[model samples]
Target: MQEFEEFIQEKMNPTNIFIKICTFLLLCSTLAYGQAGYGATTDSVYGSSLAILSSPTTLPLSPAPAPSPDYEYVNLTGLLTVAGPFSTFLKYLETTKLIETLQAQANDTDEGITLFVPKNNAFSNLKKVSLSNLTSDQLKQLCLFHVLPHYYSLSDFKNISGSGPINTLAGGSYTLNFTDDSGTVHIGSGWTKTVVSSSVHDKDPVAIYEVNQVLLPEAIFGTDIPPPAPTPAPMVAPDIAPVADGPEVADGGKGKGKGKGVAANSSTPSSSYRITGRNAWMWAVIVPLFVGLIVVL
Candidate 1:
């Protein structure tokens, strides 16, 4: 029983208990520090990856849209009726149902229409002559006479100038003449001679030129057309005569004057020598008289 008590005392010694406590505390501290360091490293790595993902990057933008084509369907009626005080011309076009044809031509991209728009004053000038006198077909043909089947800009008139008569939409004898005076464009329809007052529209597929007078076709009017005004005559410059050469008699007269001067000079020296001799004779006589007077005294 005494040996058992000694063994129990040795197993439960204070030094061994203290050493076990210290070893357990050191193991716990090492584990906690290792876990904290591992958690901090993991958080730092995750934050770095998140920052890289959240960062913005440049990307290409979409391209701009293309520009529209030059050829476009222009509203002829709206353009004329609104823009121009071409209300009279528009009424004629509408009455003759030619506006649809013009609009159709404007819609065509391949070919275009050249319209000669007469102003309100132009129609008013024709007030004395009633359009009611004409038939429906004649009115349509008259409206067609004002337009050409093809588009012609103000600059394009030069190409057709003096190139003979250009066929109009009326067909047959309904042709017109074009003459370009410098940059100005003049149009002749046999009955009327007018010029383009202004350009209303000059886009592709449509060209409208404002004219001073309404175009009157020879087909409607008789072929007994008036003659064109005569061009004014150019000013005549005065004639200028060339200068004549010097006369032979004048040259001879100058030579004779020179000879006379030489003769006069030759005669002057002889007269001067005679005058000197006389003066010397007088001096000799005076000297002798003076010497005798001195002796008498």
Candidate 2:
């Protein structure tokens, strides 16, 4: 019995040692595979993040907007006060308080004003009775007659000219007539006929033109405008062609005929040639008639 037990112990010891060695190898392989997988996953995640951060290309951000501009105003009083030695007209405007009205019109953005300012002498030269005789309302109208509510550049005169009388700031028949001759603009208010002799200030929103005479309205002056002096007839040196003597036929009773020629002058050779040509033509016709009459008789 002792010998049989010893043999069983020896075989069991060899089998147990072989099984423990196989189990240890399997655990070591599993630990190595897990380490490799974690290293690869960590490297891929961190490397991708770093690559994105280092790249030169960047996504664009939204843009901002731009801004706008401002308004412009013109000064009228300053323009007139300096441009014209227009003190006399300005005095009338101030006295009538029409200057304020004109200044407001000049500043208008859409439609501006045009003023025809007469020189100082225009006011002085007027017959004393013409202005002195007027009432307060008439005086105001006289001042108002000089302004056109709409701006009119010199070139723009062509369009409004010949359109009959244009209404002035005075409103009613206290209007003025405009006529454009070539580029010259003529203003006729019946009593006053004048021209835009010069431009004091010509700009958008304000235009002040200088006139030689104050615009005299027919509404104030009686319509009995004097008959315009007749222009003397032009003297034309006499055209000798009309009074020229042509060839005359002299036929005596004896049936002999002679042609009398037009007397030619040395100074008028061209005219003499023309008359000779006409005389030859006439003689040709008259001779034929005389020959026909003689044959019939």
Candidate 3:
């Protein structure tokens, strides 16, 4: 009986060992599958999508805004209204309706307008018969004669000067000769010659200069224009100032007298010479006296 029990135990022990070996093999396979599935990045199901996200491509961005235009707005009516006390000129412009033509030219940026406007007093000083005898068409041409169809800055006239007569807005023979003398712009119509007193309004596409006299065109007033008034004699008279920048400045006024100018400073040098000679004489006396005292000692 003991031998039979021992044999049965040995057989059961071997079967138990076989079962444990199978269990160990199954556990090792499960651990290797889990490591391969979870540890490797390429083994993931989302690998392709992750690769796309990690790529070095440029992202889409919002486009930039458009640039603005360079057009400037200039209104003539509003400008002349507040520019100065040229109401007489303004009234004539309104009555003739020439402002529309001038304003239209001002609106164009490419070919702008340059105008010469006279003050109220200029019209007041004008002879009534000159304007009173003009027909509507003649008056319109006369007003148009005051303006140039092109824009010219004050400095630009320097080059335009002495280039023969340039065309005015009045067209045809109604031309004006420009002379820029020492930075001053002078306009010469056949009937009237005037200079730019001041700049009323200066800007791109529009330039309005103030003139002392009303412009009368030869087209309206005829070519029998009177000669320019003779220049007034200098207050100093010809004998007073023989040359330019003369020394009339003795009394602190510009006398333009060269001799007087030198005379103004001549007193100072004479005074300095007198002081120097007096000091030299004093020094000579003192040095000799000191030398004599030393010798005596």
Candidate 3's C-alpha runs over 4 A off are 1-68, 228-297
- Ranking, lDDT, top scorer first: 1, 3, 2
Measured with C-alpha atoms, the lDDT of residue 30 in candidate 3 is 96
lDDT score at residue 5, model 2, on the 0-100 scale = 92
lDDT of 2 by residue, 79-153 (tens): 667887788888788888887888788774468889999988888887633687888888899989999988899
Best by TM-score: 3
What C-alpha lDDT, on a 0 to 100 scale, does residue 4 get in candidate 2?
81
Weakest lDDT window of 10 consecutive positions for candidate 1: 243-252
For residues 32-95, could you state the per-residue lDDT of candidate 3 as single tens digits? 9988878675556478777778998788988988886565777777777898878888888899
Every candidate's lDDT:
0.83, 0.81, 0.82
| Tens-digit per-residue lDDT, 166-228, candidate 1 | 998889989999999998999988788899989999977788989988888878767887666
Quote each prediction's TM-score: 0.52, 0.52, 0.55
Question: Pairs clashing in candidate 1?
Answer: none
Relative to the true structure, candidate 1 reaches a TM of 0.52
Clashes of 3: 8
> In model 2, which range of ten residues has the least summed lDDT?
251-260
